[model samples]
Target: MTYQESHFFIWIAAAYLLGSVPTGLLLGKLYGIDVRRQGSGNIGATNLYRTVGRKVGVMTLVGDCLKGIAPVLLARQFGLSGEQIAWIGLAAFCGHVFSIFLKFKGGKGVATALGVFLALSPLAVLVALILFVLLMLKWRYVSLGSVCAAAVMPLAVALLSGGRTLTLVTFLIGLIVIVRHLENIRRLLAGTENKFKA
Candidate 1:
């Protein structure tokens, strides 16, 4: 295959690998505690923060976010089409949600999803951030706010893009985000979910 043709597979694989880095696991290992075995028994930034401390949690969040951003940005450097970019975003999201290194079990993909959308559509990201803050502050529930923010992403992209490929991609990403939070939703419904502290 030509170099241009080969970029399709190369980009997807690279993005997936980037997404599968497992920032939470690395942070937990750094602290000598398996974060998955601790609070929430999940390998996400929130659990990492609850298990370790603010510093480690912050680092994990940054790493996870960067993973999504980096791959898509790199793909853009190759002058890919909008559809290709959307595919890159999807692959990256899947990698984060089902990382290969983590036995195909990974985080809820909120932060990583945000990273992809943030880089691909900054305006949508800004709107989602605003919604996230409003919901979180009004309800004092991070998961609720996060889910609402994710749900708004596709709408925001639609408003910004006029139903382009990015719109559909954002919608799919938003749905994936919600699906990843199913456990949190169950906990929230049962009133057993813990809220984040200031």
Candidate 2:
């Protein structure tokens, strides 16, 4: 590969590694627990809150969100093109979805994707966040709310930014988030999905 390609891959790898930090898992350990072994068995903030405490949950959320933001921002600072920035964001989201440190297991990519979108298309992310909050408040189901927001994110990005690259990245992130929620989907269908306990 040429030097440019190598540099591109390096940034992508860095982004993936940043996303693979397992913020929730590490936070759980600080409290002497394994987040992946408790509650919904997810390493995301919701599971952390349910298994640990609100503070730890919020901390993990911030850490994970930063994981998403840092990589894309750093790539942008490096003068990468918009397409490269989008790819880096997607790589970070993929890393959160399939963490190397977790033996290729990881959390659903909602929060991390949100962070990426925050950099790529702030207004679209804002709309999606509002939708998420409204859905959660109306239905008391975090998973449902996340899924709904994710469902709308691709169109939001497309319409708001008119950036095909970012829109494609958003669609992929949303698809991955939905796939990661397969068990939750089944539970929802059976009317057995756990409502947000907050």
Candidate 3:
């Protein structure tokens, strides 16, 4: 393999390791709390916010977002093509969804996926963010907004960038996010899903 080819695995490995850092759980541990047991048994930002605090939750969001953005940007800066960057992003997203350190259990990959798409197609990500915010404002259900925004991500990426590979990556990210929200879907159906409080 060429030098660049050899470094591909390095970048991917680095991304996965960085993404696998369970920011929420670590933060909760710092405060002597098991956030997973407190709220929704999730290690994502939302669960952190609900169980920990807004500050810790924001920190987790930033940390998780960086995990997604750092590797893809680094790969791109090293002159990797769109497809390679996409793979790097996917590796990071997968790390979040199935964290190695968490014994293959982790967050829903929402913030990490946000960071990935922000680096891949910022405009598309911005549009999806707007959709997510609007939905959240209207329904107060972060899960519903996440599911719908993920569902819209591929269309946004396609329309804004016309990137076949990026669209494919976004679609897969969306699918994983939706699947992760299956429990929320069940709760929504049963009218037992929690709503965000002002």
Candidate 4:
């Protein structure tokens, strides 16, 4: 393979590895808590915040966000194309969702996808964030907000970035987020999902 092709693979691998770091799980361990065995049994920031403490949860959120942002920024610094960067972002998101370090299981990929889209299309991310906040304020269901924001991301990217590759990647990431929240959706439908307490 050419040098560029080799570098692409290297970046993809690095992104995946970075994304698979399991930030919440690691933070929980530092506090003598196994996030996977607590709360909703999720290693995402929300679960960390719920089971651990707000500090650890915020730390996990920042760490996971960096998992998405770092690689995309590095790829851009290395002069990779937008399409290539999108794929790298997707790789990071996938690693979070299907973490190799966690027996191929992981969190719902919301914050990581937020980071990815923040890099790829900040306007889209802003729009989605607003929708998320609105939904959360109105319904108090984090999962519902996440699912709704994710469902809107593709359209937001399509309208703002106007790039087919970015839109497609965003669509895939959003789809995965919704899929990962399937249980939450069921609970929301049944009025059994927990609401965020602030």
Across 1-198, the per-residue lDDT of candidate 3 in tens digits comes to 899888888888888888899988999999999888989989989999988889998999998999899999988888998888998999999999999998999999999999998899999888989999998888899999999989999999899987788888889999999999999999989999999864
Off by over 4 Å in 1: 1-3
Ranking by lDDT: 4, 3, 2, 1
Angstrom error of the Cα, residue 75, model 2: value is 1.0
Question: Top model by lDDT, which number?
Answer: 4
lDDT of 1 at 54: 88
lDDT of 4 at 159: 92
TM-score of each: 0.94, 0.97, 0.96, 0.98
Off by over 4 Å in 2: none
| Better candidate number, 2 or 4, judged by TM-score | 4
Better of 1 and 2 by TM-score: 2
Write model 4 residue lDDT over 72-178, tens digit each, in one string. 99999999999999999999999999999998899999999988988999999999999999999998999999999999999999998988988899999999999
Weakest 10 consecutive residues of candidate 1 by summed lDDT? 160-169
Tell me the tens digit of each residue's lDDT in model 2 across 1-198.
Answer: 999999999999999998988999998998999987899899999999888989999998888898899899989998999999999999999898899998989999888987898888999988989999998888899999888889999998898898788888889999989888888889999999999877
Tell me how many clashing residue pairs each candidate has.
Answer: 0, 0, 0, 0
For model 3 the local lDDT of residue 31 reads 95
**Cα distance off (Å), candidate 2, residue 16:** 0.7
In candidate 1, position 26 carries an lDDT of 85
* Whole-model alpha-carbon lDDT for candidate 1: 0.86
State the displacement of the C-alpha of residue 161, model 1, in Å, after optimal TM-score superposition: 2.6
